[model samples]
Target: MDSQEDLKRCPVDFDHESRTHASNWPTEFRELRGKCPVAWTEKHGGYWVATRYQDVVAMAQDDATFSSFKTFDPHSGEVTGGITIPATPIPRGLPVESDRPDWNMFRTYLNRRFAPKAAEARRAKVRKYADSLLNRVIETGEIDLVNEFTGPVPAMTTMELMGLPLEEWREFADPLHEMVFTPKEAPEYPHVIAGVQWIFKRCIETFHQRKTEPLGDDLLSYFAHEKIDGRAVTEEEMLSFCNNIITGGVDTTTALTTHALVYLNEHPEDYRRLQEEPKLLPVAREEFVRFFTPIHGLARNVSRDVEMDGAKMEKGDRVYLAWSAANRDPEVFTDPETVDIARFPNRHIAFGAGMHRCIGSFMARVMFEEMMHVVMVRIPDYRTHPDRARRYTSVGTINGWVDMPTSFTPGPKIETGLVL
Candidate 1:
């Protein structure tokens, strides 16, 4: 029904796998939105890009139409792609990749654990971890925030929450960090996949242990003990659930903290404001989430014929909800480019909307606030060398910094009673 000119006008050569393109994506997204809000891309087996805030939100809200299932073998016609743009080689995790009833079952059980109040209750633990990390670097006068602090805080916290071995934090965190950033052609790709496989094996062992002897209030125990449809959870479901929690819990927050530190270091005034007016940190956190949109956007598969913004999308087509672009939509936020630390009514979708919204959002917010507070107070005048920093490529998965070299005046170590 469409002519060559129509197709040419609608097609935008947007590739998330390209680092150069990812780096300057906001500009491209802006241009695309102005010309074609829902442009079709020939890249990655061809998919739709929803650039505007309204369009993205609408697609996200209608999960029935825009399914999260990943179709790996296009020839096989087997429908099973999760949120990732090019379906991840690994199995799709529970709740996130699943439709209702199953999704509702998982959420109902885990919701109480990640509620704001429960996350708040763990503030002391988070502070202890932050202080311990800062203590190691305060005397050195210089540090790599990504390797030393931001990466570890959430990884360690998630390990603690899951009752995973704290000693294995590096084992757990390394792959997640590398997988999201490294390209498939890079030498690190295979190693990262191996590391992820290692995690899967570890999760399976833990699941079995928890099933036999339920332990503390950790997620492992909950998942092991929780009954679904009056029967014990299967090994596959446990692996899927644990995988989702571990992967989701670590990398996203790490990327967020890294980005926030970089931004605040560039704009010292905002950093000072955070220190002087700690109350504003909550609102500022939301703004940072908006500005960074760390994970970028997630993908959804069209289950049925749908038309959006004058374009018709047929069933089996994949559409990407550009959260990062939507966050900067002029229609949604006035001067969306500018970072207003105290932006009120900041309804950002850094956390995906609808049934698949991030379960660890409350934990993310609490940890981010405390981490910022600690950094602002301890290393007030820290300076970052962007030239020395390494940013992630193929930001289709997560837009984050790899190495952030920072220096500040050496300060006395705090006596927080938290030993490294």
Candidate 2:
């Protein structure tokens, strides 16, 4: 097993970002977990995939050994140590893409807004957004749930929390929705890059403006004119932090919700069960999160030479912590492929583990619950058009649907009584 050929036998053909991987990744990950828990791949400039739950958890926890720090030089086209493999050409976001002391400051700043109690307090806002979004197409009977419903609620909620104009949610969110899964060779790739650049441009401007404006109760105002590590937060760090919030905030819950919609559409019994007993939505949400794993696996950079579960990782080597695979590992989950909504004590790593774990996780849960509960009550008879449905071309970054056209018995829209 130590030989190069033995490693190759672990199959050198895996590529998470490929179109084929979009369709066959679960099967491929299953094989990898069974054969080589930590296998190498030449794809994306060669990185190791840790499919075992224990190994991924270990790597995620030991951020010192597996650094989240990254740097991108736009002029030289040099990229190093980011969450994504092949290293994104764009600037890396804060906290998640950093290590140790620098990361801790950002994390602490964000905690005030994203902590469990803070997120819980946001349920009313989330529900109001969800209701308003549904009110748009509830009477149409036919709509693209992904475009109209799931996508907008989270985006608008994020904008509201940040004290930004709610009308501009789509402008800020669409590019990110496109960039996460688009293949590099696609004609739209350059467009996506431009949009991403525009995002940073807008973020930089807003951050600078916030500094001079009167402080408010919103998250951005709190961050505005803030000092970190004994100095004002720099422009570079500001843009990076803004990028992190937008990237992580807008799309993840939508991905999970759309995926669950597609699933429940295919399985009527599960839909009926949820509709019958609304209290079970939280349990089902965890199961869906575990099953879909919207953010498939996040990338990590090896800080120093280390070996885990017999995979000898070297300094500066890139690694992918396959949360999707870990969530489905037979060793950790009984009947791994089966979907049991009531599975308690589920040690799923869907939100990841350790220090750099998703900061918006509590916020995401509140968002999902409100949306799911509303959909269940309002669109109980809804049916998705799988034949015309569109999924992400490459699911390496986000395992999600692009277009989920659904039709339901036309229902009267409720009076949401909320205004931007």
Best by lDDT: 2
Q: For model 1, how does the per-residue alpha-carbon lDDT over 316-378 read when each residue is reduced to its tens digit?
A: 778889999999999999899999999999999999888788989999998887787788888
Give per-model TM-scores.
0.94, 0.94
Q: Per model, state how many residue pairs clash.
A: 4, 0
Instruction: Report the C-alpha lDDT of model 2 over 1-420, residue by residue, as the tens digit.
Output: 576535333445788888898899889899988888998888877889899999999999998898889888989989888898767777889878989887888898777778899999989988998888788788889878888888888888887777677777777667777777677788999998897777667666666678889887766666676677678777787777777887887788889998888888888888888888888888899999999998899999988878778777788788999999999999989988988877877889999999988899889999999988888888888888878977888888888988788999889888778643
Query: What TM-score should be assigned to candidate 1?
Result: 0.94
lDDT against the true structure, per candidate, is: 0.83, 0.84
lDDT of 1 at 118: 85
Error of 1 at 45 (Å): 0.8
